[model samples]
Target: MWDDWARTAQPLKGKVAIVTGAGRGCGRAIAQGLAAAGASVCCAARSKSEIAETVALIEEEGGVAMAFAADVTDLQSVTAMTHATIAAYSGLDLMVLSHGVALAVGPVETTDPVDWQRTIDVNLIGSYYCIRTAVAPMKARGAGKIIVVGSGQGHNGTASTSAYAASKAGTWALTRSVAAELIGYNISVNELLPGNVRTQLYEDTFGQVISATPAGGEPISSKRSHEWLKAPEDIVPLALFMACQPDIGPTAQSFSLMRRV
Candidate 1:
């Protein structure tokens, strides 16, 4: 029974994937989902304990995974993650850049330049670090999948989020440029823009916005409010589709779950 079950569930069987910022939320979900589909996932995150928990969950479910301590902003850390993955799993096939940071909201004038810099460093630069290094083995092998978790703000601008918006937009552009470079290599690079899911980041950032508003009328429109935000799991199917189906999937393109109802 165990052997049969394992064989049936192994689509990504021996493939190795590195999911950054996988300590929690979207990254964690993506890591587990890939593992469930038979991928030996390396859950990379800055937090050791958090990533350890993620790996534990995957192992508990009979999936193969490893928790890695890594900071996406540092190419060295990201490169080490890829190196470790190759050492453990023997080959690299997928890279999920799900790491991101959302700073406290405030008007442009009120926003701190340092805070803004940090935002770009995490969302844009950090992603670049992961991609630049991960592409090595992929490019050498001539096949791989790079799934970037983007934000709606990248395409559609939002108020009081200047830094985040710019950072995300830059990340998407980076995705397109890299996709073009991977054209004939069989390496698919695409950006997966997530919807308004009430994860820890969302609650910490936007929750404050709603709280600061004067009592009585709602601050944001109903369409963009908490009531409309879907669970993180709701967006996982599309993420998995974009991830596991690289050959037949679109590359140098961007897809989003922003159309939630």
Candidate 2:
């Protein structure tokens, strides 16, 4: 179903977009979704190979996209990426703040403060930097869409996920603040929690599939774990919907595609 859209749709025709962490997983899938919708996309990540892979997939489906290397944690890096996008695609229309880093599950006291801070640096600070830089060009154009990829963890606390949860919670609030700042200017900002994407990162970090969740006993740590859970591809449509920046309201809103079905 998704592959078909990649070749036929043009809903975002001529729009320019930037998707961070696009080298793989959900980021890559969202990048594909944007390109499939006819947006000229710039895929950004720390890995050149992964970014290239994403670009290749888009090209294979006859979509327009390019890869860029940038560390989302650094302001200068993100700034340069935005400027580069302007040079290539003229302007920015959509920005998907999807890059994230996870901390291992352990006792809060056992966690190094440095590790906790690093997680915040990637999941929260990085998002702030990208949002800050992307907004300028977007504001100048008097129109833009910003989608912050939040987590269910943000809504409530869970054991062993303090850093991830806290950071995402911060991101969700930040989205509201940013939306308030730009809503009157015609730009729309919103949050979308892609409920439960089954990406390789989850598999690797958890060492099991979605079934192995904290509440679920004895996780099925195998390829089957990858099956029952929603894949990155499943979240594409919602991300695309957010990309369109639907006018259900003024801005600074939040949406979710929590169900795999």
Residue 100 lDDT, candidate 2, scale 0-100: 91
Q: How many backbone clashes does candidate 2 have?
A: 0
Name the regions of candidate 1 deviating beyond 4 angstroms: 1-9, 211-219, 222-228, 246-248
True-structure lDDT of candidate 1: 0.82
lDDT of all predictions: 0.82, 0.82
Q: Compose the digit string of candidate 1's lDDT tens values, residues 24-92.
A: 998888788888778899999999999999999999989899989998888888888889999998888
| TM-score for each of the candidates | 0.90, 0.88
Looking at model 2, report the run of 10 residues with the lowest lDDT sum.
218-227
Best by TM-score: 1
Off by over 4 Å in 2: 2-6, 208-228, 246-250, 259-261
Candidate 2 TM-score over all chains jointly: 0.88
